[model samples]
Target: MHLTVLSRSPAIYTTRRLVEAARERGHRPRVVDPLEVELGLGERPALYHRHRRFPRTDVVVPRIGLSVTQYGLAVVNQFELLGVPSINGAKGIAASRNKMRCLQTLARKGVQVPNTVMASDASKLRQLVKHVGGVPVLVKLLSSSDKGGVMICETLESLEAALEAILGLGQNILVQQYLRGQDLRALVVGGRVVAAMRRRARVGRFARSLAQGAKFERAGLAPAQERAALETARIVGLDVCAVDLLDADGAPLVFEVNSSPGIRDAEEVCGVDVAAEVIAWAEARFEAPPRARATAARRVPREA
Candidate 1:
């Protein structure tokens, strides 16, 4: 099978691991920056790489960065038009990339999430924060990734200032109830929770971000949390993703569903062959609908 990985940083661990995994499985793989892939539209939609028409692709693994999400998704859509399947489809990526929309979708699907509220009117910012159970609130931009636009405000004055800064930049924000507890990053592939880890923030830090000196360790998830992660992935239309859960008082609340989650963290902490599993899933997924190939065992059984 011929596979293509859509990514900007091919030298990165995740991209390199995926390339190696695919080659080990006897599949031809190449990593291409999505920004460089050119699209041709008309009666015949097509994609070109470096001025040359791309060859037939059996599967595409999109690791679209937030910076080029729109263009990356357009490239993926072109592949879909050519009948090539992607691990996480373009629609899924779009949905997951928009933090505000993702949270609203999950809540509408009866999934547990942080108490979140978004306000387009800056005048209502205070009320929005209050609606999410008051100050000491968590604020995040709708399209921020990797903790780029996240902050915590402990006082009303701070909250107002934060809102002013965000609104000044012409970005929308979501104010969420500050759920304080351990952070669980659950990696779900093909509708299953493959691995989970507890992300511990650095001393005196409340943000459990992998980029901010947070360390990961293997962790066990309760049955409900496992189910929630799986369901969240399904709802977001992601075949492979990482669902972030906050263990707030023994209850798990979904905070984010990342369509293009890094596999390195899960691999490093859990010792799981994440890249290999992804390649295997892609191989099987190329042959049939993902749902048809998915097994019942991937789901946690419900007790009567």
Candidate 2:
């Protein structure tokens, strides 16, 4: 099999680990920056890598970061349309990437989520916040991307200011009831919750995600919370996902579902062979759909 991995840092731990494992497993693997793939508009969309012809690919593993998704998913989607397998399909990636959309889907799936309201209309801002309820409110950009752009406002003046700042981009802002308590980051792969960590803000931070400077340690969650993580991924149509849960009075609230979930945090804290496991899972999933052209080894199946 031949694999093309789309990631920003081919040298990064997770990328390197997965690439090496692919070679060890006797697959031809190429690491390509998705941005480098040129896209053109036409009757039939197409992609081309500059100065190089791409070999047939069996699957594309995307470690797409928020910075890259704008152009990255185009390439990944090309692979999908061309009948190449993707660890997480384009719709799954896009749905999970947008914070607001992710939560809406989770809620529709009967998953408990933070009381969230979205509004961009200057007239509706106050009404939206009222729906969320409380003096202190959290405002998150639906597309915060990095583990950031989330504002915790403790006063009415600050909350209003935060809402204005977030809405300045001309898109709706997600106003959520701030869940105050412990935080859980659950990494799920192959429809299973592989790891979970409890995080305490480093004295001043509000979110348990490392992006908030929270210190973390491995912790066990109630079976309900664990099930929530797995179900979130399943409902989101993901092969792998990072589901962030907030434990407020032992009830877990799904805050985020990340498709290109970071492996470093999960691996460092949980000691899981995340890269190897992801690669092996891809291999197993590939077998799920039988092939017309079969290769014993060292071959890229002709373009499907």
The parts of candidate 2 lying over 4 Å away from their true place are 24-26, 39-47, 121-130, 135-137, 143-146, 153-171, 203-210, 288-290, 293-304
> Which digits, one per residue and each the tens of the lDDT, describe model 1 over residues 55-116?
55678999998888889999988877766778999999999988888888998999989888
Total clashing pairs in model 2: 0
Q: Residue by residue across 236-258, what tens digits does model 2's lDDT show?
A: 88998888888878788988788
Give the C-alpha miss distance for residue 32 in model 2, angstroms.
0.7
Task: Specify the highest-TM-score model's number.
Answer: 1
Off by over 4 Å in 1: 121-127, 143-147, 152-167, 203-211, 288-304
Give candidate 1's error at residue 199 in angstroms: 2.0
Q: List the pairs of residues colliding in candidate 1.
A: none
What are the RMSDs of all candidates, in order? 8.0, 4.0
